[model samples]
Target: MTHRSSELSIAFALLAAAAAFTALPQPAQAQAPAASQPTAAAAAKTGLVDVTGARIHYQLYGDLASGKTPLLVLHGAFMSSDAMKPLIDPFAASRPVIAVDARGHGRSGGVDGKLSYDLMADDAAAVLAKLGVKQADVLGYSMGGSTAIALAVRHPGRVGKQVILSGTSRLDGWYPEVLAGIAHLTPEVFAGSPIETGYKSLSPAPDKFGQLVENIKALDATPFAYSDAQVRAIPGKTMVIIGDADGVTLDHAIGLFKLRGGGDVAAATQGFLTEAPKARLAILPATSHIGIMAEAPAIAAMVMAFLDDKAPPPPAF
Candidate 1:
């Protein structure tokens, strides 16, 4: 193959895999908002909450007690809260934004050999409880979105409206290529990349990036699916968002959406005569797993609108 063909092949491979967290803004982009909006640092404050097996680090923007439900933002594997700024900035403009750096990632510490989504969910709840938030909305991307699913599933009362962006309910929901790519998520692949630099800059155990990867791999290797009954039992309004060309299979996305009470034939037959389903699904065009967060502001707007569920009576002015 020609050099350009090889490059294209590599690019396509990356697109086919959820190889890494997709939303790391270029260091220069920190100051460059995708739109005219608050920077990540605007009104932001940081904290660490002690939880079993982890000292979870979190950043907050806006006031938790400002009365609007806070939006808890979680980053994917190898990403820091900095990665969530796109989703955070828009939410914080209207409500509190609680961005957590999950165990062994970013500034969070106290990594254990058994760090699962359940543990991460509990850690997030502990932080919210510490801040006296009984319940808040959740918006998580990638692995963070899986953590959000675990949170809503395990602690239904703690999550109000939940948004799962590029998250999977079952490991098999991922395309085979993406599943195979997990083994490539070694520290060596990330060496000298922002994933490494970001961890070193923010992690208390900066030397443990390799360990973090191993632990995450272990977590991934563990069985991670809930029975259909368990998923349907959760009593929270949920939205599942995915890119059309994402690592997640469209069939899996639709199945998960249907499991969450997504739209059905009732809508086509009777429009307003029927109530909307509690679940929402969005499939963005021309997007892939790696570019999911490139349009963060737009995604945030959809999430905000979903959570802001107030509605006027009807077609009357």
Candidate 2:
């Protein structure tokens, strides 16, 4: 099949998923969102810190005191830290991991307050400060990925090597259909989804799920994006990962990689030897927007490869 055909197929499929959002069956009961522990069994801690007009919620797995760089994991909009368990488990097993619930999300506060990507990124930094974490590697999915970019651009010192999963720096990076779907999102659409139930189970204000949905809609309506200079100026090395059929367009993903000093040339070309890209890009096959998050093991492996970064010695021929 042609590549364009595949993209259209994915786009239509994504639309179908979007339409199903409001049609999900209601849950029988709500329970506290599950706490995802490390596979290697590390000490776990949870905390709340004040940032801007909200209280941010976070969970730390593994030992902070070990002094190894921590990995900050940010969930998609309306998703709790708990829902990121698949990605968290493997990273936690290796080094420290911080899973955050953005303001007005999960167990955090200010459900109806104004929010910007810069503000959300600042909140993550504030949480790090409260916990006395100086710097961390970041892995953000969807909305979290957008915030991760802001964090790197705004608080360069607070981030180490970073990974952006299914994230776009500009809103236009997403397909128009996807944005339309997001525009149509109503509290009723989440009446029975984990996004709603998780909020009910873990939010400090359990009765505010509808308000949270409204907040997300408003947040999406606002234009939140970084300039080309801002993206090019990010000090740390970066890796951008996406599913073949993700909401982020292939062109945008390629643009991000290029903006970050990647895809300058083929790796083995002589020109590449003089100027290798400090960034990396991966497009996973047979994966969609939602499917990418669930493929944690594979994703974690790619993350570790980037983190480890053992390059072969240059040939002398």
Candidate 3:
């Protein structure tokens, strides 16, 4: 979702209702709309609905005739529904595809001045319920990846399969300096000043450096700490993907990889496969965190294939 500068002001106002101050500068561009307003041409073939609480926006494509399980795409932080655009056309051609703007991003509404994974999970549930979808193959990228895990834990019945891309089971010690830097920024700086230097250490594309900086700033600055035991409890088919070069010292991705066991795609793959034998991991050679999505079509294809396999069989003639 793209937001105009004016809408950013409104969003800041809304966000401030719960907190006393803001942490990030507004992006130079307006906030993307709450949802993509597809053209009539696209609308006829798709369904758009606003889930309750106005916190979830979903677009459904493809008919149930295929009997294929629906695929739900969730985006990373500070990103809008458009982030999943690359996979939508291909995935929707065979099975139903639904992409959402998580609360506080894109077109989704924020909860009463606070952002919590539980609330985000609730928003996902609301969207699924609104569509009357019993189960879906889910894939979340980056922040959405964590949100997807929360959904599986909170609403296991609704998840047929799950994929976590460049995501983590816990947030503690992930990026202390980055988080602290974001918290230190004043609302005025967040809304008008350039982003701090900490963000540059993580993002590959430094062109929109300020935007990336502000995005981290706008994210739920509240510290998030999750338990390893809590993550192990998530039930369903699952996979974890990460690049070798992610993090300050390559520790971010390496740590998560090690947490799964031994920091190799094979080891992580085996861990997940042991639980859900069908689960697998793909480590893109020479790919970094940000570069993985754009540079690694194979990874995306693998995810699409997993969703396809989980989809219900096509309807009979």
- Give per-model TM-scores: 0.86, 0.84, 0.64
Worst 10 residues of 1 by lDDT: 11-20
Q: Name the top TM-score candidate.
A: 1
lDDT value for model 3? 0.55
lDDT digits (tens) for residues 1-317 of candidate 3: 33344445433332222121122322223222436322221331333345444446566776644677888888765555555565465566567777876664554544223456766777887777877889888888767777887788788889877777776555643445434444444435444322222222222343344444344554546556456565545555666676665322245444443443334467456433322234545665565445455432355556765655554234466
Clashing pairs in 2: none
Which candidate, 1 or 2, has the higher TM-score? Answer: 1
Better of 1 and 2 by lDDT: 2
* lDDT of candidate 1 at residue 106, scale 0 to 100: 80
Off by over 4 Å in 2: 1-43, 266-268, 271-277, 312-317
Candidates 1 and 3 compared: the better one by lDDT is: 1
lDDT of 2 by residue, 106-183 (tens): 888877787678888999999999989989999998888999999999899999888999998988888766765666
Supply the TM-score for candidate 2. Answer: 0.84
What lDDT does model 1 reach? 0.76
* Most accurate candidate by lDDT: 2
